[model samples]
Target: MSRLTAIIAAVVACLIFCLGWLAMHYHNAASKQQTRAESAEQQVNAAEAVTSNVLTTMTIFNTISEANQHAKEQIALDASGASADIKVAVASDDCALRSVPDGAVKRLQQYADGLRQGAGGSATGKPDS
Candidate 1:
């Protein structure tokens, strides 16, 4: 009777040890999975942030390009009109040539030529022969 009781006691101790080991094993596996999930989430967030920045940068570049093109076109138009106005005023005696500095007129012509070339506009403000 003592031998049977000792055997039963040993069996219960072994079961308890097994159950504890299994619980610890499962707990470690769950912790590892949680860590991997968290890492994946961080990676996803980083990718999203990078994508957003890239899109914002592209939009800014596009806006700047458009603004530059528009400004160039406007400058070209203004140059052509100024030269034309000068020629008309001279011919009609609306303003004297001396009143308009030759140096300023030359600089304006140069600037207008560059703007027209860049903007792809035909030169229409030729001085009267």
Candidate 2:
């Protein structure tokens, strides 16, 4: 009877130890899962913010493009000798100009260069009369 009692005690101890180990393991796994979920949420939020910013920038760019086109048209019309000074004044206003597209400023500079050359040629008596 004494031996039997000792064996039973050992079995109960082993069972208790296993239960405690399982509880600890479960707690650790739950903590890791929670951390991963929070990390993923943060990433998603960052991505959304980036997307929203890009969209806003694109909208602003589009608005600028449209305004630039309108201004250019007005300039062209004024170049035809209709209220030239007014058109030039409007175009000269910084706020009236659109945010030039990437590389567009270079193209504009090129056009300006051409105009300068033409003006110089005309002034030098090389007009294509």
Candidate 3:
């Protein structure tokens, strides 16, 4: 009877050890999965921020293009009957001190000339004359 009781005790100990090992493996797998999910979320956030910045820059560029077109139309109308020298001097802005502003002024002048030369004020860089 004592030998039978010892055999039963040994079987119970083996089952308890197996259960503990299985629990540890399950915990490790769950931790790895959580880390991967967090990394993916961070990448998605970074992509969204970049897209938002690009959109803002494009909006500002479009606004500048429209303003340039409007300036060209008004200058041409004001200088329609004036001499060539007077037309060249029109739309001269005092705040233009940089190279970029110089380029903008040059672009406006070309547009104004196109409008007066019977091309109808277009700034699409196509030859109107």
Q: Each candidate's TM vs. the true structure?
A: 0.64, 0.59, 0.55
Give the Å shift of residue 15 in candidate 2: 0.8
lDDT of 3 by residue, 55-111 (tens): 999999999999999999887876674666664665485644435678678878888
Q: Please write out the lDDT profile of model 1 over residues 43-68, one tens digit for every residue.
A: 99999999999999999999999999
| Candidate 2 lDDT (Cα, 0 to 1) | 0.84
Q: Which candidate leads in lDDT?
A: 1
Model 3: how far residue 104 lies from native, Å: 27
Query: Which candidate number has the best TM-score?
Result: 1
Between prediction 2 and prediction 3, the one with superior lDDT is 2
**Error of model 2, residue 18, in angstroms:** 0.6
TM-score of model 1 relative to the true fold? 0.64
Candidate 1: where is the Cα deviation over 4 Å? 90-129
Q: Candidate 1, overall lDDT?
A: 0.86
Between candidates 2 and 3, the one scoring higher on TM-score is 2
* RMSD score of candidate 3 (Å): 13.2
- The per-prediction tally of clashing pairs is 0, 0, 0
Question: In candidate 2, what are the lDDT values of residues 13-65, reduced to their tens digit?
Answer: 99999999999999999999999999999999999999999999999999999
